[model samples]
Target: MRILVAPDKFAGTLSAVEAADAIAEGWSRTDPEADVVTVPMADGGPGFIEVLHASLGGELLAVTVRGPLGDPVPAAVLKVGETAYIESAQACGLVFLPTEADGRTPRPGVAAQASTYGVGELIAAAIDAGARRVVIGLGGSGTNDAGAGMLAALGASSEPVKAMTSGPEGLAHVASVDVEPARERLAGVELVAASDVDNPLLGLRGATNVFGEQKGFVGDDAKLAADAALTTFAEAAGRKVADAKGAGAAGGLGYGILLVGGRREPGFATVAAAVGLPDLVATSDVVVTGEGKLDWQSMNGKVPVGVAGLAGSALRPCIAMAGAVQVGNRELRANGIEAAYSLVDIVGTEESFAHPARSLAAVAERVAKTWSRR
Candidate 1:
């Protein structure tokens, strides 16, 4: 039996590669004779480059950049020939969100202060590496300033734009918008913002409204303030980009990229094509894919669902395994997941998290026993 084992990061527990390795270990336990292919997956988040680098060879160029909270963090730029891939999360990821690290208990008032400036640094590094094109994986962000911080890192002059408090609260105060400096630096370069969501940059489906709470901008007052400020920023830039598809990505980083002439592309499709997932699925008897959590969002171009879609089209069964399962079996089936399992269900939530590798392997072994020999 040929089983394709692919899983995204288990949030803070394991990386895509680590999860794949654990799943493979479990399958080996139940069906040692079964042939399993481990392909780590990503949807333009933290593990974007590492996942692709695993399947398609690439040189990872490491560089130091500002973290979400302005701390220096080590980041990477994946170089594949003349094209450079930058995962935005590497610079501005929520994983870098200020918390106890900010020297506070319970993490107070750290959300709105986060920035995307570090992401811009990575972009600069890519250009400096002689990359003719840059692919930015935009997700897992820590700011709601609509890419204002990124622009700042790319040499957007703060000299003209006063009222620089940072984050959404001060976005409207940005007086001058300049892309010439960035453009000169990016001469002969193409910027691509790779994202999975289609939400615009404003309104209920927009960045602040939809994703602000996670980053700590909560309640009605904060939302309105951020929205108005972003609106002001759009006017300042002489472009109304709030309603554009993918404009809400990465706390409006997509909109910012668009303002600077960067185009948005589907992250899943881009990574899929790069890894030749379709061809691999054609030869597999069973496809197994998963992420940390399985919910309504999984239906919207998440890695597991994307993999399942490809496997389904090839008439192969796709199974999903996750740490937690929030949706019903019918919903799972509708999304091309023939069966679904969760670590929280098999073991308790505590153990499921504490021992993800062991938990994942246990689940994979059970699946292998039931489905592999079929």
Candidate 2:
């Protein structure tokens, strides 16, 4: 049987490639003769660069850029012809921050102070190197600045550019934006924002309300930050940023890109087309795809759901193996997932994740055995 192994990153543990390898290793033990194909997946987030690099032949360029809290960090971009692939997570991802720092832990904050300036710097660098097209992967950002930082780096000033770029409050202090510098530098470049979520810039269902808690906002802080940034962005751009779908993504980096001539596209569709997932599914007997967590949100434009949709079209059975499964079996079945299994359910959350490799191997072995019996 031809079994395709595809999985997203296990968030805080294994990358999509590593997870697929672990699954393949375990499956080999259960069915040595089985044909297994591995395809790592990403939803425009942490693993975006690696995925794009693998899908499109490109050279990885590493550079030093500003981090989420203004610290110097190593970042990379994929150079593919006149188009470059930029993953925002590398510069301002939550993983860049230490879980425990000093006496008080640092939290991902909402506001314009936490800008996407470093991301802009990366894009600027690409532009300087003669890139005519730029595809920015918007996922796993830790800030909520309305892309003020990005505009600042591109020489678009909405107030005096602050020396210390740190949090939302810091961004709120800006007064005006000037894009003449970047406009001259990137006059003819095409910018595309590849986004996974579909949230807008402002409102109860916007960026702060839907994703702020995940970034550490509590009580009214998220709402206040979102409102302040939205107001500033509207004043500067002369266009209402509120209610724009997918504008709340990547800590408002989505809106930031739009202000600077970037268009938004569904991340799953982009990646799938690049990776030739539909073509692969046509010949595969079984397709396996999963992520760190599976919930109601998984059905709403996530990678797995996209994979399932494609698999259904090709008349192939699709199964999911996740780090944690929060949705019921009925829901998964309704979504075209023939079976859904969680590593935590079988071995307990704490124990399973204690050694991610071993846990993934165990789950894959069980899946292989079950499939062999059928």
Pick the TM-score winner. Answer: 1
* Runs of candidate 1 exceeding 4 Å displacement: 100-108, 158-165
Query: Per-residue error at 149 for model 1, in Å?
Result: 2.1
**Against the unseen true structure, what C-alpha lDDT does each candidate score?**
0.83, 0.77
lDDT of 2 by residue, 1-374 (tens): 88888788887789888888888898888988888888888878889989777667788888888887777889887898888888898878766654445423445443334557788889987887778998888898877776667767787655546721445676455566676666666689999889877788776777777777666665686567656766665566545554577787887778877776678899888788878889988888889988888888898888888889889999999999888998988888888888988999887799777998789888998988887543
Runs in model 2 deviating more than 4 A are 97-112, 163-167
lDDT of 1 by residue, 1-374 (tens): 88888788888788999999999999988888888898898889889999988988888999999887778999999999999999998888877765565532224346666778888899999988889999999888877777877877787755346333367656666776765676566668899988997889888898988987777676888777777777777667646666889999998899888877788999988888888889889999899998899999888899989999999899999999999989899999998999989999987799987888999998888878878784
TM for candidate 1 is 0.93
- Which 10-residue span in candidate 2 carries the lowest summed lDDT? 103-112
Residue 140 displacement in candidate 2 (angstroms): 1.1
